[model samples]
Target: MSEATEVKKVGQTPVSNSEAVKVANTSGTTPVDTSKSTDKKKKKKKKRTNISKIENYFPDGVYPEGEWMNYDQDFNLARTTDEEKRYLTRDLENQDHWNEVRKAAEIHRRVRKNVEGKIHPGMRLTEIADLIENTTRKYTDAEDLTKMDDPTSRGIGFPTGLSINDIAAHFTPNKGDKTILRYEDVMKVDFGVQVNGNIIDSAWTVSFDPQYDNLLTAVREATNTGIKEAGIDVRLTDIGEAIQEVMESYEVEINGDTYGVKPCRNLCGHNIGPWRIHGGKSVPIVKNGDITKMEEGEHFAIETFGSTGSGYVTTEGECSHYAVQDYDYDAPSLPSANKLLETINKSFGTLPFCRRYLDKIGEDEHEYALNYLVKQGYVQDYPPLVDIPGSYTAQYEHTILLHPNKKEIVSRGDDY
Candidate 1:
């Protein structure tokens, strides 16, 4: 995160420094004419400051460069060795996966930016969820999955998490859900798209009320701080500490009372690989003494979450997201469960998915098949993650590769 600017305008959240520069400049005074005039009186050198380009942070134009992260103060680092560093990188070096994940992340970000306006008060939650998923298809390989040169060229990797207000994550509206967006609501729209089994997982919060502005700002900064700590040699705990530090540095006020802001400790960044949304090592918002090294040639989504309530979040209500618990389990089962399992295994493998993706299932049988799979333990469920009710939460995420000497932020695009 660049420290060149500090004034963040209302509703002007930017995920990258390049974005910050544009927003900072755009939100400032009106543009002036740039006619090159040699007249001394009319000629004034307007000093232009371009913060360091994000690309130079990578080595060989692809990896992250950083000194070895310092060991945790509370935990001894003597057990960690060079072997542990290599233990973290698995199936991330392939260019195909890299390209696909980047595309998937960019597509999701593009869709979020496009459908943000549809999140206003009174909009049906189900309608908004349907729109985002459908729009994501229109923008990605799902646009022509059957006819594409490669079948894995595009499609959604996970269910769109349309969590709103007190709901933290994994809450896409169930069928015929009547929940509607309300005024002054804080909505966290978390979604993902996968290309050829490579997934790019990212999320953001859209809030219309100014009262929660500072809460959002804390999480955004915490995410940037974590991303800045991502590199080839940085320790996972170091990243966690930095994120928590940023998160706890602020206090948010709602209705004349101040609430101590903290990162949602239960939610943290994780290493992601092909179809592996939660892989490698866990990077918690608060340091928990997990001494894992961030290795070169690994892709990690550094997630930062700030909250106005308890940092701890728990499962609630029915789950919309699920994944095959064991791909090799082929025990005999009812025809409905078996059929659903077959489709899931063939289409999604081990990736987390939602009931909405089973759009082809006969409407009457969808519920029965899903219940059978869940009851049989063949499918794992992902319920909504929530803090105590009335709490406010915000999250920002970015996917990156740690190069030997530098790092590449793969998910940021021209519009970010």
Candidate 2:
């Protein structure tokens, strides 16, 4: 029979008597035909496409969605009344709040994973920043938040920090940065993603040379230690002490020189509020006398930096990170500065942004205006936080949500 005829007759054709008897006699049992059953099974199977797989990440059936990260609950943190528990549960279960946070975390996790092992020795710092930011925009569907259906729904939480070597944090490339990565350099990749002002601030370190492996490991373990020790009503000092103990225990040897890792005392991770990266509380890396306790329903970025040089960071180099101040301030007298201020207020609000972002959005000749705003205390400028020259530094960070019932590491991933 022809191929088309045979395929058409698959489930409709009946077996001949001779064939049935032959099969029954050979097997010593009755033969059961399965063509119709097999055809039914095949018809029932749904064809999976790449679009379908992508759609699975979006729980709300929206485009450009992210998968939810795994979470666990800690019931032993603090005691709550039944009524309070119900209230807390309602907050935790609110899809509008927790789901947005999870989506942002997943976008961060995926963007970090996508850029891993892609940073080579000769790539420019600008290229690296673009790669990270573009990938984040693609995942969040906020390439141009102004044009989106909901302008403030999803976007970058802060400027992409590509701080290399002793440069610890708050560093990103300007419009024409020519800095190149070196094989011996230890680079810290710090970035954030935000959905409805809930930011997932996380970071990891990369090194091409094996000599700096311990540096990365030390900082990563320190951050993890802080995450583990954090809970409701846990004192920030205790968490810092734990982080310091774990960070200082390791020593790195480069070219027959042994150096102990020290936590960056000045660069403590801060709490994250709605549209606020530095919310009131600061989680120190070293034991300070700050007895502030982690409260319920608070979001914090537990970041740790370990350096071979001074465990302190000073603001140096040209400033790239800028954010509008929360309080009221006088508007600039210059028309250009006033226009730029309006743009900043409308585009970024309190979320941290970089100069390159302004350029991308077609804001030209904004240098003077931006500086004037910074000078007038209407906007805050964050220069590169550097440890010391000729030293190596590494950082690791994770954003956690302190629920009334459990502590959820929103940015937790397998890579770090």
Candidate 3:
């Protein structure tokens, strides 16, 4: 091609072919390489991909519906103010709430470490529960007010439940229960700590014998597996399914028999909120078709209770744990009922508190008080879980903050 095929000089007005020729000749530079320029133009036309359609941000199908990380773009707003951007992007508001949650979680972790550290094979279950609850008060800062709305009411949202052996959870020692831990027993302690009613629920099993070690390990792996498969907008069902897969993959040797492991189906981890322990949505150990999506700024207790027996647990013993019935109703006339109701509403709110927790309020007749509240529909008793006799159970848990980029395991440092 002739020089007339190109402009005489770059950035100058487009000249006629004859003028371009003269300008190129006088400029003392070779005629422009139109082919190279055309190649550069083609390079600049690279396709702009819409990241909203990308696959899951976390690998291994953590987000079942694929990662919807484009929250800002999904809203279909091209231009947004900085204030509006905080809704899509994590801001100080989010961090502020997380800070309190992390603080409470750390407190729970440390106090639990101190309490459980003293556990021995001969330790009484009642003493262990007392030790845990007392130590929790030592580390916590709960202040009861006349109403749950009071910001001052913050502390052990879910009281210590020192469940052992077949008891998967919801077992705290009553005033005179003389159960003791044996060398071969598997102990599962489930508890929660709250800061301004922001809850971080967690649990774990401890076994001294090497035989039951694998059961503890299986539950731990299942819990972590669930956490790994959790991310923003992930299907709640996928998390449960992944946990079940991992739990079943583990094999444990018990009583000279090799057994495959799986989580108890009836019991599950739960979504947590301020002043609410298990309300948002239940995260089952097995899939149950809950398509609820985990959003940012939400908290969850990712827990697994793996058992050597059938993957089912039933409440067959006395209820040692209690929670206020989360219904809108008026208080009853029984003096003991009103007394327990006031204490629950003031401090525990809708969260679960131990039957022994009433001791802190100087209540000795807990059975009658609880019974009164139960009959009045002011409280619900969480009965102790019983597995098939001779079969063992183990548990592992962690609290998580479902941020867009990743999940923050608030109680991650707790021993697995």
Candidate 4:
């Protein structure tokens, strides 16, 4: 897709997906190969990544898609009002879908850690990317794991955040790209994968600097606070507020300049579901809107993150992907759009919109095809930054299931 057509997010423009990638790649600081004098030091200090065992981590009784055998009233507070209860019931079904997603995410995280510590700086980005993809291939439920091999296939997108010191995020190193890792530079590895339509969202920064320990500590604390304070019947804003409060407490001075931290405006956490990669509601780690209530049986990725720079963010980048759905020309599909249901079914099969597939279709039929695809749960849009400066971003996320009696965190530290 061209950059011009991508501007219209959700039927917004002319920027193509390819144009967005070009713009994002060129906009970031030029990648510079650095020295590895500290390589041995890192080798000695790097901790082994011990991912949790699948059987022990995900017990048999722990079913995904929010099927809790027991529901407590305290946890059911979100459904207090009769109307609210009805709404909560529907949300619970959505939560059930998320439960599966949470499991998928947990598995992805484990897969990542299985090789994370062993991968050293100075390795070709493509090499590491291939390894990550291969790890996923062994376990993914997707019919086509081969798509992941292609950087543009959307099978499993690669890392863009941890390229080097000057580079920030959204980088997919091609086989010909001459970029290599370095020791002095901290690497941020971020990946997302789906299982049975459930999405796993996560990112990690691997740094050699001792100060990184502090950064990790602060970020983990802020993230935990956001999770601890979040609950059913709770507002969404509270999650961000919790993150903000924790971050503010640790505000520090760098190079004689006083600076507080904030999450890159572009990196807010999101809601996920059976058919949705990034759901309708966005949960910001920093306060922005009303507090979103937490409901029992709801599934979510509570990611608490902040950066050392200005919290403001902007993306002029073209839309690289769009969640296309089959819709009739008779009515719009955005707000309470149920009238277009039949059109969607007739137009596309039960699959979400994926840009790779759309590029092959004709322009006249593209819209209908996308609409139908999205409606069928085959397509989902992924917007890419075009001609926008990249920023340093960090995140700590865990796919979780909210239980009335106990909260189930899918991604736990490895016991082995």
> TM-scores of the models, in the given order?
0.74, 0.81, 0.75, 0.59
Ranking the candidates on TM-score from highest down gives: 2, 3, 1, 4
Summarize candidate 1's per-residue lDDT along 16-94 as a digit string, tens digits. Answer: 5444445556857764433333245566779653322222332243422222343332333432556455533543445
User: In terms of TM-score, which candidate is stronger, 1 or 4?
Assistant: 1
**Model 2, range 113-210, lDDT digits (tens) per residue?**
77877888888999999888888887777778567655556778899999998899889989878888888888899999888898999999988889
Off by over 4 Å in 1: 1-96, 143-153, 360-364, 413-416
- lDDT of model number 1: 0.70
Model 3 poorest ten-residue lDDT run: 61-70
Sort all candidates by lDDT, best to worst. 2, 3, 1, 4
In model 4, how large is the Cα lDDT of residue 14? 71
Model 4: residues with Cα > 4 Å off, grouped in runs: 1-106, 141-170, 251-259, 316-391
Model 3, range 164-262, lDDT digits (tens) per residue? 787788888777787878888888888777777788788878788898877888789989888777766777888889999888988999879998887
Worst 10 residues of 2 by lDDT: 64-73
Q: In model 4, where is the ten-residue run with the lowest total lDDT?
A: 150-159
Q: lDDT for each of the candidates?
A: 0.70, 0.82, 0.72, 0.52
